[model samples]
Target: MPRRHTPGHLPNDRLTELRSSVRERLGAPRPQSVHEHTPDSTHEQTTYSAQKQTHDSVRGPRTAVVIGRLLGLTFVLCFATGIWSHYLQDPLPWMRFPTRPAVLYQVTQGVHVAAGLASVPLLLAKLWTVYPRLFTWPPITSAIHALERGLTGVLVASSLLELTIGVMNIYHWYAWPFSFRTVHYALAWVIVGSLLAHIAFQLPTIRQHWRSRPSPRRGDAAVDVSEVDTGPAPIDRVQTDHVPADSVPADHVRTAGSDRRAFLASVAAASVAVVGFTAGQSTRFLSAFNLFGPRRYGDGPQGLPVNRTAAAADVLTTAADPAWTLEVRGNGIVHGFSRSELEAMDQSTEDIPIACVEGWSTSARWTGVRVRDVLTRSGIDPHSRLRVTSLQTRGGYAVSEMGPEFAADELTLIALGLNGEPLDLDHGYPARIIAPGRPGVLQTKWISTIEVIG
Candidate 1:
């Protein structure tokens, strides 16, 4: 025989009987007390234990919420960090750091790439946990929702395509003709704008949900109560009530089966993507360490083979400070760094690729003081745009202004080495510059003077 209940609350005797029945079924000790409480201040705490099972079923487990929260937090952090890594520079003055071989650049770049790859898994997990709500037609009533969706679509498409091409490029798989950086940069704005809007709309929802849930302690599972549909009781209680299928609705059975199949399909797809992405790639995505050392491809003029150019005048500066001065002689922008004084700042090295807008990338190992450190030593604010004068070039390279954060980008380096040896003359031997994810034109070679302008 099955137990049944009406809409009305159980009588006092029936409540007591229920408790006894539960204790016997579980072979557990009876509660210290068992009785229905009047709806009063005194009764709230008293009735808590008696209604534990019923309340638990209605509210769901604490573990479910914790898992959701962890997934959400991880995805959010990865997304923010990934975007910031691409856009923002590390704030540390690179010129002040010790100059090492370009191997350091390779390791850091690999980490950056790997973290990006891992985002696929993290993003999918987050979406899965929240996908049920997508069926609610329009999620938000305001125009903000439409704008957010638009931006998000653009960002998603851009980021995925950019990453895909980048991975292929690293492995020498060249099938795309478009300039990766140009396309990637243009799409980045869409993603960033959409991300900001998404965060804005979710702020209120996040706060409301946080307050309603109990503070999750360390090691305690986060419970997700937001998805609990208590609007109406489920008809087929196969899982909920352990009821036989004969008494359940056909729709209930169908829905449960569909959800199961969908979950399985999603898992299978994720496995395939991870495997397919790594196949035949020079650098394996699954490995924590990269076999390829730090070195950029095509640091010089693209399409042209490796060669040397003779400038009208040699502008190479040396450590010999007997008569060295950085002549900041352009547009009233005063900035100077003696060879000795420039050497006094911290040095850094990065093995970054010199990517050119002309459709090519080259690898090289750079060793020099950090440009940021040099600017700081010269008392120049990093926020100002810089005009770098090269000895081999007649004109200056007009680099845009970057906030202090850009100087901190570990990839930015004032290089002094090539291929494990001192810089060759043909290359920017005396001193050069290297910055990650930036076009080669910005990396002025044979650096003679750096002028700071507003």
Candidate 2:
């Protein structure tokens, strides 16, 4: 049976007032507080939650853009220098490299190695900033998006592998079974191609996020508020209509901008430091800064670093034998000269730098007969292409070719003396070919023969 009370009368139950009093005193749930009931307060709470979720889910666009730009610039520099190095090693007839400015290879190779090492940090940061995208729900928005993702994966894997192999090569560590040169060369192309595709796909997003500015808050007059009928929102989806104007404090926004600026500065400083440290190995002026570099300028035997000693090349016995004679052959004619006889000939001196593939170089005054003079003395054509062979019975670079341009260059020498002293046994003693703008490996040491092929 229910009790009915007259208008303006209290509850007929004697316990009603006591229950109400107790609930109020204990802070029990009520209809709503004045603040919570307002639209502004509801919007503020929603905006704050959405913002927090957004930050946790992905890095801001500004951070990604800054890191991406730095990585891209480094990649371009590395690729250009890498191509130059490859071409220098395996030359084609269509292209001719210069014989002047002997330290060109030194500078280029140093930059290549330095830029590569610096890119490691930049690449890691970039990947971390955008890592959330790798797990995007639905995975693909369209066929193009799928292709972009595939290319992105390729870019990441190849870049990391390339850097690993490159660093290993620098230290002369070969853990992998495959040929480093062949694989590295092939992967360079793959990386560049995939990088281009990635840029094409993300250029729009990159542009949109290049500048740092506050995004529009939710529930603004310009935005339409609507509810979705879907069962649940995707992790990547942000509800833009529920953000209040004051959800993000002005101080937080300024701090974020400052943090981004500081991060970019830190990355730039790190890159510069890396380059300075490694480039010092080749750049004499910067040698003081190469605290972590493997080799320093003006180091090794005869003030020039030796990649392989005579013993390592298996030329120790042959190179030191008194019976050693350099044979010059051309057009069915062969002329042999002993070390003494070679030294007796009219000598010319030229200052040339020995630039090695390992990115170290040193300049010295080399004294000997020019390749052209030697060919002429042997009754061979001065402009003919020549093959220079070493006393090294076994080695990949035991023999090297001298193009017509190199053969005719006045500075190309069958060097018998370095820095006005007799060539040291470890420095290609007796006689070695020294040419301008050539890698140290190609400057065949302990020379036994030179033949004109064309």
Candidate 3:
């Protein structure tokens, strides 16, 4: 019934049919291979299903948002207080600091240093949670993305330098070549600007994860939203369709959640620990608990921690000179007072905390002539601004500016005694400025002259 076929050859009609079938198959439009992708970047055709899985437990947008919020809060606090401190230190011609609180600078500076230290942990955690973005796929997907990444780089670099130098400054370490104040202040602006820009770029993602969204079947090998940057996450996901190599399988979903929780707990604990140890330096009662603080609040000459010893300032010889006298100079008026004369004038004692820029502080009983009384004796306006000079010949703080409120404050004193004892040779023996509501640096030590200024 069927035509007989040769072993190695087919009939002419059969061969023609076979050739035609092959030609049709070759000419038909071919389906794209799973490994192929176009330049438009609609989908990422990955050969390996696994993507990067580092820190998967804590590597998500949610963690980033939480840590970012905390880091942002501290940065805000640090920025606010830091600005206050800078203004106080370098007041503009029209600026005048308040005098009522008396310990305003103390509190503000303490907050500044405390926030700075607290940021250490928050910053580290934030970096850890978001570092994966550094290796995001299609690393330079577009020019806008490239610029966004550049912004992120600036934000991170400036933030690290800021926190690093801030911590160094608190310890009174000047290992850098640049002026800490100048660089620190400038970096603050950079950080704030970059931070704001970053937030604007990330608004969609931040809002998306501002509150938790429903999880997608737990561990369904989902793409990490945090890696999506500040872009519209839904759209980014559609385009990228990335699944991190480290994503847990559905069976391990609970384990992933547990790991994330553990990571968060660890970060919180670290922050608490850092605050516990360093914040105590500003709290007098917590002095015993402070370990890493550069100065102990209770341990120094005359029971006050002294950052710069009279010896270190090279004022030891000049301070002890018997002729050392505090001179009050004003418009056509000059009055000088020996240590005995200062103690002889009406003495005022104020138990106030003297806080250093470094953040350590101590409550001391300073008894000496009221600054207003001296200004009045010198026939000068008690509220006149002053140029206070220290006996130390060499030092940036050898001379300091004084606001009128300090001269007018009844509690402001040129102290010759501390804690019921005469000033120690190391404690500005002849006399030292002790003003309220100001930084200790302005409490110019080893006083030599006070001149009234416009």
Summed backbone clashes in each candidate are 29, 1, 4
The list of candidate 2 runs beyond 4 A from truth reads: 1-53, 56-58, 211-247
Q: 154-233 in candidate 2: lDDT tens per residue?
A: 99999999989887887778899998888988999999999999888777557645665334543421221122111122
List all candidate RMSDs to the true structure: 14.3, 11.7, 12.4
Q: Which one wins by TM-score: 1 or 2? A: 2
What TM-score would each prediction reach against the true structure?
Answer: 0.40, 0.80, 0.81
Clashing pairs in 2: 218-243
Q: Give lDDT for model 2.
A: 0.71
- Tens digits of lDDT, candidate 1, 1-454: 1122211233211232343454446666443322323332122122222232222211112222333354344335434544433443322333232223323333334334444444455445444443333332234445755665566556456656755765565444668887654555555555556656665645443443443333322222111221221112221111122223333334433443365445444644663455344321213242232223222233233211132243423443342224645554334545665655556666565656544322233455666777666666556664455556566534334233333343445656667666666655545545666766554555666666666644
lDDT of 3 by residue, 323-412 (tens): 888888998778889888887778888876788877778778998888889999989989889999998876667888888877888888
Candidate 3: C-alpha RMSD to true structure equals 12.4
- CA lDDT of each prediction against the hidden true structure: 0.44, 0.71, 0.72
**Candidate 1 lDDT score at position 221:** 17
